[model samples]
Target: MKVTLPDGTELQLEEGATGGDAALAIGEGLARAALAVSVNGELRDLARPLPDGAQLSIITGKSPEALELIRHDTAHVLAAAVMELWPGVKISIGPAIENGFYYDFDFPEDAEVSDADFERIETKMREHVKAKESFTRQDISVQEAIEKFKTENQDYKVELIEDLITNEGAETVSLYTNGPFTDLCRGPHATDTGKIKAFKLTSIAGAYWRGDAKRQMLTRIYGTAFLSKEDLAEHLHMIEEAKKRDHRRLGKQLDLFHFSEISPGSPFWHPNGMKIWNSLHELWTEQNARRGYNRVKTPILLDVDLWKISGHWDKYRDNMYFTDIEDRPMGIKPMNCPAHIQIYKSERRSYRDLPIRYSEDGLVHRHEPSGTLHGLMRVRHITQDDAHIFCTEEQIQDEVIQCLRFGFYIYEIFGFEPKLELSTRPEQRVGDDATWDRAEAALENALQAEGLEYELNPGDGAFYGPKIDLHMKDSLGRSWQLGTVQLDFSMPERFELAYTGDDNDEHRPVMIHRALFGSFERFIGILIEHYGGEFPLWLAPVQAKIIPVSDLFNDYADQVAQTLVDAGLRPDVDARTESVGKKIREAELSKAPVMLVVGAEERDAGTVSVRRRHNAGDDDAKLTIGELVDVLSAEVAERRRPDAG
Candidate 1:
């Protein structure tokens, strides 16, 4: 049989030879480093036989696919160790997640396991890695596989097999065995346990089986693995830094916002939080206005029939909050696009108004499971910086480019470098293939026209359209999806949105859904962590704090505060009658960007001593009140970052 390598080189091998054989045929070193193989773009186990003329790429530790495989193999080792330590532990499923892996297990009632048990489990995992247990795969009839697990009291495995047979029409199931433990899986794991070099069990939590709240609760153990010790150490350090910069903790310490039992996943924004929100809103408004976007407001609750017309009733009802209002079924909107469509259709439009942009800081609601909700990142109530552009088909590419540019501009102001991704249609979308092809092509062409590089995210688009998604990397090197521009043909067709053509004939319009800051709540959460709560002057709730050296200087502090307030900046007078040292310490702790100390000398000089939080610079630099206001105002006007001079 012949196989093609990634570099277009052809390799000849005997029939029925496996990927491991091909790797050895290429070189001895490759075979030793090979973890798996990608055959014709599909990942396969090294022991799996290669087909004739298949394109094969050997995966080594340096390959991007290696971490997932290593993490998955580490999970298998974890399950093996758990089963050995606690006999008769029923394992449900284990898979690699972002940066790590987790396995769900139904432990016996007599067993007591927690994070405290992580050390012993990790010790056993090290033993497995040291033993160099080879991962062996076997395919068996569904009945035989079920019987094998049933005899071991693995009911979860039996249920999984039954579902696969019923839903996917499977005739056989694959099983992988490493040393004393075997699991039902379709795997492309590392060649052996020894390939897992550096790993650590992170934590444990209770999770519902299959994420169904009604199903049996299982104990889930999370762990991360890396191919080298240095990588693992770097990742562990990032984890510690992430904990210190957690948005939830910062939110409380900064008195930004808080979640309460009165409103489960909704935030009660404090004054400080509102200040940040208003600053963002001002930016959002100014950008939209400059781009010719018409701001509009939409109702939160609308009749269910409206949703049915938009296909949200069929496609997104599960995630929506619905109510019976006046005996009419109503849905609390999970999105603003549908309502924007109605506004476009409210009156007749012409080709002259081909691109009618409607922007909204729309409040929306969605049904989120209590367990899945995080501080502000994942919430039931949301405030979307949403917009819809109703444009002619001929205008799609340019409008999409404009949206891309708009998103890039907003992210730049926050010091984020965004990466672009073109997401294609999903399997369960509403649009036809031809329409989908056009939408996807338009987006790709726009990116190409702008000379912007993007990744292909397959089958992850919105239900109505293909989209260009912008994922920004924060200061901590963590990526977050912050913006999206979706090109939709289905919704306009569904709503029968039309405009008069130049020839006076009616023509269908294309709908582009865009949001730069995906949601105010989530964006703020990211900002909190991105800046480590030391916000820039423009976005900081308290731009400057005025501290008096003594009670005699309190009057000067209040006068300086009034001057700052008149200059359109948020300033607070620290007249608590405390010592100057304590006031300075408290101001720094509050993450105030600037501190102004007014003493008798400064009062007579008509100047204030300035201190910067984190001492970025300018400690004890005295400036007159006018000079101080001018500098602070310029920083706020330019939206300068705290770290930037």
Candidate 2:
């Protein structure tokens, strides 16, 4: 057999040799360092047979693929350690996630597992790594696998195997063995446990079996692993930084918002939080107005049949909140597109009014799982920056281009570096293949016209249409999806929307569903973490804090604040009768962008001493009251970031 390396070098080998043999033929060091093999662009286990005339690339520890493999191996070792510690514990499934891996186990009631158990578990995991056990994979029939688990009283494994055979039409399943521990998995694991060098079991939580609330709850252990200790330490540091930037904690500290028992997933906005929310919404409205979009409002409670016509009832009824008004079944709207369609159909249109844009801050409701709800990121009620456009098919590409530009403009205002993704149609999509093909091409061509690079995400678009998703990276290097521009041919047809064309013939119009800020609550949550609660001057709830150096100058502080308000600035007097240092500390903790400290010297000169947040040991800059108002008002006007000049 002839095997070709990427460098165009061919080598002769045995007909049924494995990738390891080819690596050995190249060099002993390469063979020893090989973690896995890429055969014809597919990642494969080193133990797999090398096909005739195969293209092979040896993956080493330095390869990006090695980390996930290392994490997978670490999870297996952790499971081994658990079984060694607590005999007779029932193991479920373990899988690798984005930054780490987790294993779920159904332990005996007396096992007494907790975060305290992590230390001993880590010790045993290290012991297993030191033992240097090689992983072996075996392919067995489904019946054989089920019988094997049944013998060991492994109900979870048996259940999984049964489902695989019944649902997936599986005849064979692979089992991976690392010494005494074996699991049902399709694996390309590390050669030995020693490759899992740096790992830590970070936390523990409870999860229902298969995420079914009625099933038995199992203990799930979460952990992360890396190639080197230094890399692990760096990841741990980032995690610690992320902890400090958690929005819930920052929300409490900054007095932004809160949740209560009365309304489980609803946010009760304080003055400060409402300020931020209103600012974002107002800016969005203003931008829509600039683009010739008309603002509109629709009812939140609609007859359930409306959703049935929109195709949300049969597929999405489980996630919708339903109610009975006078014994007639109605639902809290889960989305705004269906309502927007009704508004569009209310008026007649021609080719001259072909591109009619309507925008709204639509409040929607969806039944999210209780466990999945985070402070403001996920909530039962959402305020979507929703907009819809009715246009001729010829205008699809151009309209998509404008929507993309508008989204970019919004993200740019928040200093987010935008990344674009073209999400393809899902299996359950509404439109025909020809319409889908045309919609996909229009979106792709718009991206190409803008000269922006994007990745293709298959089977992730809305059920109604294909979409272009926009993700933006924050200051902490975390990505968030902030917007989407979706093209829909199904809704217009379903709604039977029509317009007079250039030829004076009635024709169905195309619909585009767009949202720049997906949800106002979630966007503010991202902004809170992105800025670490210290929002940019324009978005800051309390733009400036006026702290009088002493009570003697309280009048002067009030006067300073009044002057700021007259200049259209949001400022408040921080008069607590505390020491100047204490007041500064409190103001800074609240993340106030600027602090105006007035004292005897400043009051006599009609100037206020200014201290900026996060700037310590710096001499105060004294500016007259008028000059200070100019500085702040200009910042508010320009929407400058804290670090920006």
lDDT against the true structure, each candidate: 0.93, 0.90
Instruction: Determine which window of 10 residues in candidate 1 has minimal summed lDDT.
Output: 611-620
The candidate that wins on TM-score is: 2
Each prediction's TM-score against the native? Answer: 0.90, 0.92
lDDT top scorer: 1
Clashes in predicted model 1: 0
**Segments in model 2 whose C-alpha atoms lie over 4 Å from true places:** 4-10, 40-42, 62-64, 138-175, 179-185, 209-216, 324-329, 427-433
lDDT of 1: 0.93
Per-residue error at 149 for model 1, in Å? 5.1
- Candidate 1, pairs of clashing residues: none
Q: TM-score for candidate 2, please give it.
A: 0.92
Q: Tens digits of per-residue lDDT for model 2 on 474-586? A: 88788888898988888888889999998999998999989988999999999999888988888999988999888899999999999888987889898897998898888
Clash-forming residue pairs, model 2:
none
